[model samples]
Target: MTQFASLLLLKTVLLSGLALWLSVVVVNNLTAFRGGVFSVGSMMAMQLFDQAPAISTPLLSRRVTSEGWHRLVYGFVVIVEIVVALLLVYAALASLGAFLGYADATAAIGYANLALAGFVAMGLIMLVGGAWFAYYIRQEGAQITHFALIGLGLAAGLVINIPTP
Candidate 1:
């Protein structure tokens, strides 16, 4: 395969991976995100409120309480995830189509946008939802590592999407 084709394939893989991973996260955390009858979205919200330390010490600095705002934040999170996942999935399919000779160079550029869109949303989740809301602290810094790795993956995909001479 040509270098261009290889790059397209790489972008396809990256976008598809992100899409699949997002779907998995949502499915795995249904109790925390779903709006269904049995869903415990409120519990997840309570968890969010609990993260905010009552007494703001010199170490942790600021704390946020989302008692009544949990569902709203959870909804926002779900919406962002849904939108980004759809974009990634579409981009992956487009990238694959381009790889198979169905599209031109412009499709390659679209892949970068698709990846960036998802990654930017994810960055918001990491920074705003995780760091600002202290999800990392409450969850033992669990998602921090995943967030960094996803950033790296998005960067790699973006780098490869740059046009070559």
Candidate 2:
């Protein structure tokens, strides 16, 4: 029973982190749409085209292009997101093992702590990722993405120090 409880807690934390990350991604994309810089379709098109910047009048008129930089930034965001997803998956699996009674309660608690640590780490990464995204967005004349990032970071911190077993 104790093992199951720990597993439940771990699953909750992992799922919550994933949900928060997805929310942040959605909010960021929405902000981009509101800026009129690019629609979802246009963004998809750009991504399809090797994620090159749109050849709009403003961008084309500039001698020094920021397309490469933009691509690099987006690529970094994607990589971080993938890492977070993997961490969450590992947490889920650990939780599953605990719930199945395949692991002792004490060990399950330790696993939970590790999962929480991963979540906290992912949250920090997301915060940094969001800051970078905000910087890039601001350069493109958009608002910051700090709110979601900060909220997630705080939530993750709270979960990380949760009492185990």
Per-prediction CA RMSD (Å): 4.7, 8.8
Clash count of each predicted structure: 0, 0
Q: Give the TM-score of candidate 1.
A: 0.69
Q: Give the alpha carbon lDDT tens digit for every residue of 11-104 in model 2.
A: 5555556645655764564456333233322332333233355333332222323545445545555455555555555555565565565655
Lowest lDDT sum, 10 consecutive residues, model 2, at 134-143
Off by over 4 Å in 1: 31-67, 134-143, 146-150
Query: What's the C-alpha lDDT at position 130 in model 1?
Result: 51
Best candidate, TM-score-wise? 1
Cα shift from native, residue 48, model 2 (Å): 24
lDDT of 1: 0.61
